[model samples]
Target: MNMITMGIEEPWFKDPGVADMFGGKADVETIEGTNIVIRIDDEILDLVELTVARFHDDGEWVWDTPDAYGWTRNINGAKEAAMKHGWSEALLRLREVVPSEVVSVLDNIARMAAAAVRN
Candidate 1:
């Protein structure tokens, strides 16, 4: 399958609030700009496992988290996705932790999302 692999945009992009897969408290406010609240329980974990079980469903299996420019084949589509999913806030928080390229991507997407709402 010639699937176009997608790299993670930032370390905190998936769910920054999730400290770990084990029972960990969410990082509600430490994210600074973003107010994203994540509460992962057994059910959420179960669902996540069903999708991918690379580490044998072990939460401790850390991933080689990537730092890339909001990776996506489509830039405008990424912006629209961020807007549709209320991820602009998360992107704001992610911008602070990622590299300059990542920051620029997130900032651009966020600005576009904001402008889209006004139109």
Candidate 2:
């Protein structure tokens, strides 16, 4: 499985208060702009695992942990997805299974992914 690890060490992005929301070990060194790192690994990473597990059981769990960036990353990704394959029926089905907020972001991400693939 492809494993990706993204981390951010920005002042606002890694704000202690926000970092605490996600849970322990969500903090990175405070800096200016956030940093995101995605890489393939020997095993699936936590983010992918959480998404898959929650998706399978239709669970509702907010990501309290601080990502490299703030909430905007989520929105940006979703929008990118929407610009891609035009949000297919199957993708929508999977997306709908998640919470509305998350779905919104993912819907956009789907478009982004599709567009990236096309390119």
Report the Cα RMSD per candidate: 18.8, 18.0
Report residue 66 deviation for candidate 1 (angstroms): 25
The TM-scores of all predictions, comma-separated, are: 0.19, 0.19
- Evaluated at residue 86, the lDDT of candidate 2 is 27
Error of 1 at 9 (Å): 26
Top candidate on TM-score is: 1
lDDT of 1 by residue, 1-119 (tens): 11121122232333443344323432322211112232222111110110001122332222211121122233244333333344444344344434554556778999999999999
lDDT of 2 by residue, 67-105 (tens): 111222343342333223222322343344435545567
RMSD of 2: 18.0
Q: Model 1: what TM-score?
A: 0.19
